[model samples]
Target: MASETDLGHALPASLSRPVLLSAVGRVMKSARAAAFTAEEQNSPLALRAYDLRHAAVSTWLAAGTPPPLVAKWAGHSVQVLLTVYAHAVDGQEDAARMRIERALADDDEAA
Candidate 1:
Protein backbone atom coordinates (compact mmCIF):
# COMPACT_ATOMS: atom_id res chain seq x y z
CA MET A 1 0.00 0.00 0.00
CA ALA A 2 1.11 3.57 -0.60
CA SER A 3 1.96 5.84 2.29
CA GLU A 4 0.43 9.27 2.88
CA THR A 5 1.50 12.56 4.35
CA ASP A 6 -0.44 15.50 5.80
CA LEU A 7 0.47 17.50 2.68
CA GLY A 8 -1.31 14.83 0.53
CA HIS A 9 1.74 14.47 -1.74
CA ALA A 10 2.75 11.04 -0.52
CA LEU A 11 -0.65 9.44 -1.08
CA PRO A 12 -1.81 7.64 -4.15
CA ALA A 13 -5.48 8.25 -4.97
CA SER A 14 -6.26 4.56 -5.17
CA LEU A 15 -4.92 1.05 -4.75
CA SER A 16 -3.39 -0.68 -7.75
CA ARG A 17 -6.03 -2.63 -9.69
CA PRO A 18 -4.91 -6.08 -8.61
CA VAL A 19 -4.61 -5.11 -4.95
CA LEU A 20 -7.95 -3.31 -5.03
CA LEU A 21 -9.73 -6.28 -6.55
CA SER A 22 -8.17 -8.67 -4.06
CA ALA A 23 -9.15 -6.54 -1.10
CA VAL A 24 -12.69 -5.84 -2.33
CA GLY A 25 -13.22 -9.48 -3.24
CA ARG A 26 -12.30 -10.60 0.24
CA VAL A 27 -14.69 -8.09 1.77
CA MET A 28 -17.50 -9.02 -0.60
CA LYS A 29 -17.03 -12.71 0.09
CA SER A 30 -17.29 -12.15 3.81
CA ALA A 31 -20.35 -9.93 3.37
CA ARG A 32 -22.04 -12.51 1.16
CA ALA A 33 -21.48 -15.16 3.76
CA ALA A 34 -23.08 -13.01 6.42
CA ALA A 35 -26.06 -11.96 4.27
CA PHE A 36 -29.44 -12.78 5.72
CA THR A 37 -31.07 -13.94 2.51
CA ALA A 38 -30.04 -15.80 -0.59
CA GLU A 39 -31.00 -12.92 -2.84
CA GLU A 40 -28.99 -10.52 -0.74
CA GLN A 41 -25.96 -12.73 -0.98
CA ASN A 42 -26.33 -12.97 -4.73
CA SER A 43 -26.87 -9.23 -5.29
CA PRO A 44 -24.07 -7.45 -7.16
CA LEU A 45 -23.31 -4.78 -4.63
CA ALA A 46 -20.02 -2.92 -5.04
CA LEU A 47 -18.85 -5.55 -7.50
CA ARG A 48 -16.19 -3.21 -8.84
CA ALA A 49 -14.65 0.18 -8.11
CA TYR A 50 -15.80 1.34 -11.53
CA ASP A 51 -19.41 0.85 -10.49
CA LEU A 52 -18.93 3.42 -7.75
CA ARG A 53 -17.56 5.94 -10.23
CA HIS A 54 -20.55 5.45 -12.50
CA ALA A 55 -22.91 5.92 -9.59
CA ALA A 56 -21.17 9.10 -8.49
CA VAL A 57 -21.29 10.64 -11.94
CA SER A 58 -24.92 9.69 -12.39
CA THR A 59 -25.70 11.18 -8.99
CA TRP A 60 -24.00 14.44 -9.84
CA LEU A 61 -25.99 14.78 -13.03
CA ALA A 62 -29.24 13.97 -11.26
CA ALA A 63 -28.41 16.56 -8.60
CA GLY A 64 -28.21 19.33 -11.23
CA THR A 65 -24.46 19.81 -11.42
CA PRO A 66 -23.56 21.67 -14.60
CA PRO A 67 -22.61 19.39 -17.45
CA PRO A 68 -19.30 21.17 -18.07
CA LEU A 69 -18.27 20.79 -14.43
CA VAL A 70 -19.34 17.19 -14.34
CA ALA A 71 -17.48 16.53 -17.57
CA LYS A 72 -14.29 18.02 -16.19
CA TRP A 73 -14.58 16.04 -12.97
CA ALA A 74 -15.22 12.84 -14.92
CA GLY A 75 -12.33 13.58 -17.33
CA HIS A 76 -14.64 13.56 -20.31
CA SER A 77 -15.31 16.04 -23.07
CA VAL A 78 -18.75 17.64 -22.72
CA GLN A 79 -20.04 15.92 -25.84
CA VAL A 80 -18.87 12.53 -24.66
CA LEU A 81 -20.33 13.12 -21.20
CA LEU A 82 -23.73 13.91 -22.67
CA THR A 83 -23.56 11.05 -25.13
CA VAL A 84 -22.79 8.51 -22.44
CA TYR A 85 -24.75 9.75 -19.44
CA ALA A 86 -27.59 11.88 -20.82
CA HIS A 87 -30.10 9.38 -19.53
CA ALA A 88 -29.06 10.19 -15.97
CA VAL A 89 -30.26 13.80 -16.35
CA ASP A 90 -33.85 14.01 -15.15
CA GLY A 91 -36.99 16.19 -15.64
CA GLN A 92 -35.95 18.10 -18.72
CA GLU A 93 -39.54 18.16 -19.99
CA ASP A 94 -40.97 20.01 -17.00
CA ALA A 95 -38.06 22.39 -16.72
CA ALA A 96 -38.17 23.26 -20.39
CA ARG A 97 -41.89 23.80 -20.29
CA MET A 98 -41.54 26.17 -17.34
CA ARG A 99 -38.87 28.20 -19.06
CA ILE A 100 -40.90 28.50 -22.24
CA GLU A 101 -43.96 29.56 -20.30
CA ARG A 102 -41.98 32.25 -18.51
CA ALA A 103 -40.57 33.53 -21.77
CA LEU A 104 -44.01 33.80 -23.37
CA ALA A 105 -45.41 35.55 -20.32
CA ASP A 106 -42.59 38.07 -20.41
CA ASP A 107 -43.24 38.77 -24.09
CA ASP A 108 -46.94 39.31 -23.38
CA GLU A 109 -46.14 41.85 -20.62
CA ALA A 110 -43.62 43.64 -22.82
CA ALA A 111 -46.09 44.08 -25.66
Candidate 2:
Protein backbone atom coordinates (compact mmCIF):
# COMPACT_ATOMS: atom_id res chain seq x y z
CA MET A 1 0.00 0.00 0.00
CA ALA A 2 3.01 2.24 0.31
CA SER A 3 3.42 4.34 -2.82
CA GLU A 4 6.10 6.76 -3.93
CA THR A 5 3.50 9.42 -3.26
CA ASP A 6 1.04 7.71 -0.97
CA LEU A 7 -2.14 9.55 -0.05
CA GLY A 8 -2.05 11.24 3.41
CA HIS A 9 1.76 11.15 3.28
CA ALA A 10 3.77 13.43 1.07
CA LEU A 11 7.38 13.30 -0.05
CA PRO A 12 8.94 16.68 -0.79
CA ALA A 13 9.30 17.11 -4.55
CA SER A 14 12.97 18.14 -4.18
CA LEU A 15 14.07 14.63 -3.22
CA SER A 16 16.00 12.70 -5.87
CA ARG A 17 15.51 9.11 -7.00
CA PRO A 18 18.61 7.84 -5.19
CA VAL A 19 17.46 9.39 -1.93
CA LEU A 20 13.99 7.92 -2.22
CA LEU A 21 15.31 4.49 -3.18
CA SER A 22 17.70 4.59 -0.22
CA ALA A 23 14.93 5.46 2.18
CA VAL A 24 12.76 2.62 0.88
CA GLY A 25 15.76 0.29 1.12
CA ARG A 26 16.30 1.25 4.74
CA VAL A 27 12.64 0.58 5.50
CA MET A 28 12.85 -2.83 3.89
CA LYS A 29 16.04 -3.58 5.84
CA SER A 30 14.40 -2.71 9.13
CA ALA A 31 11.35 -4.82 8.31
CA ARG A 32 13.56 -7.80 7.52
CA ALA A 33 15.51 -7.29 10.72
CA ALA A 34 12.27 -7.48 12.64
CA ALA A 35 10.82 -10.49 10.84
CA PHE A 36 13.79 -12.66 9.97
CA THR A 37 16.42 -14.59 11.87
CA ALA A 38 19.98 -13.21 11.77
CA GLU A 39 21.00 -15.72 9.11
CA GLU A 40 17.97 -15.03 6.96
CA GLN A 41 18.39 -11.29 7.36
CA ASN A 42 21.86 -11.72 5.94
CA SER A 43 20.67 -13.98 3.09
CA PRO A 44 19.97 -13.09 -0.52
CA LEU A 45 16.34 -14.08 0.07
CA ALA A 46 15.95 -10.91 2.08
CA LEU A 47 13.40 -8.83 0.25
CA ARG A 48 14.07 -5.37 -1.07
CA ALA A 49 11.34 -2.90 -2.00
CA TYR A 50 12.15 -3.47 -5.67
CA ASP A 51 11.53 -7.16 -5.06
CA LEU A 52 7.87 -6.30 -4.55
CA ARG A 53 7.43 -5.86 -8.30
CA HIS A 54 9.05 -9.21 -8.99
CA ALA A 55 6.79 -10.90 -6.43
CA ALA A 56 3.72 -9.32 -8.06
CA VAL A 57 4.69 -10.48 -11.54
CA SER A 58 5.42 -13.97 -10.25
CA THR A 59 2.16 -14.14 -8.31
CA TRP A 60 0.16 -12.99 -11.33
CA LEU A 61 1.80 -15.60 -13.54
CA ALA A 62 1.21 -18.33 -10.98
CA ALA A 63 -2.41 -17.25 -10.61
CA GLY A 64 -2.82 -17.99 -14.35
CA THR A 65 -2.63 -14.55 -15.86
CA PRO A 66 -1.64 -14.83 -19.51
CA PRO A 67 1.92 -13.83 -20.40
CA PRO A 68 0.95 -10.96 -22.71
CA LEU A 69 -1.33 -9.48 -20.07
CA VAL A 70 1.25 -9.84 -17.38
CA ALA A 71 3.76 -8.21 -19.69
CA LYS A 72 1.46 -5.27 -20.23
CA TRP A 73 0.83 -4.91 -16.51
CA ALA A 74 4.54 -4.91 -15.84
CA GLY A 75 5.15 -2.51 -18.73
CA HIS A 76 7.33 -5.03 -20.45
CA SER A 77 7.24 -6.48 -23.94
CA VAL A 78 6.06 -10.09 -23.96
CA GLN A 79 9.51 -11.21 -25.06
CA VAL A 80 11.20 -9.32 -22.23
CA LEU A 81 8.69 -10.52 -19.70
CA LEU A 82 9.11 -14.13 -20.70
CA THR A 83 12.88 -13.80 -20.90
CA VAL A 84 13.05 -12.36 -17.41
CA TYR A 85 10.25 -14.40 -15.83
CA ALA A 86 10.82 -17.73 -17.47
CA HIS A 87 12.09 -19.21 -14.21
CA ALA A 88 8.99 -18.16 -12.28
CA VAL A 89 6.71 -19.44 -15.05
CA ASP A 90 8.64 -22.70 -15.22
CA GLY A 91 7.25 -23.71 -11.81
CA GLN A 92 3.68 -23.73 -13.20
CA GLU A 93 4.25 -26.50 -15.74
CA ASP A 94 2.79 -29.19 -13.52
CA ALA A 95 -0.26 -27.09 -12.70
CA ALA A 96 -0.82 -26.39 -16.40
CA ARG A 97 -0.64 -30.11 -17.17
CA MET A 98 -3.17 -30.92 -14.45
CA ARG A 99 -5.55 -28.29 -15.79
CA ILE A 100 -5.24 -29.71 -19.26
CA GLU A 101 -5.96 -33.22 -17.92
CA ARG A 102 -9.14 -31.98 -16.17
CA ALA A 103 -10.31 -30.22 -19.32
CA LEU A 104 -9.81 -33.40 -21.33
CA ALA A 105 -11.85 -35.37 -18.79
CA ASP A 106 -14.63 -32.79 -19.01
CA ASP A 107 -14.59 -32.99 -22.78
CA ASP A 108 -14.86 -36.79 -22.64
CA GLU A 109 -17.83 -36.60 -20.30
CA ALA A 110 -19.55 -34.02 -22.52
CA ALA A 111 -19.18 -36.29 -25.54
Q: Pick the candidate with the highest lDDT.
A: 2
Task: In model 2, state the lDDT of residue 84.
Answer: 88
Residue-pair clash count for candidate 1: 0
Model 1, 29-65: lDDT tens digits are: 7766785477666667655556668899988887777
lDDT string for model 2 (1-111, tens) is: 232542246555565235567888888889998989989987876477767789889888878889988888888999999898887787788889999999999999999
Q: How well does candidate 1 match the true structure in TM-score terms?
A: 0.55
lDDT of 1 at 92: 69
lDDT score, residue 46, model 1?
51
Candidate lDDT values, in order: 0.76, 0.81
* Model 2 score (lDDT): 0.81
Mark the 10 consecutive residues where model 2 has the least summed lDDT: 1-10
Error of 2 at 60 (Å): 1.7
What C-alpha RMSD separates each model from the true structure?
A: 6.3, 6.0
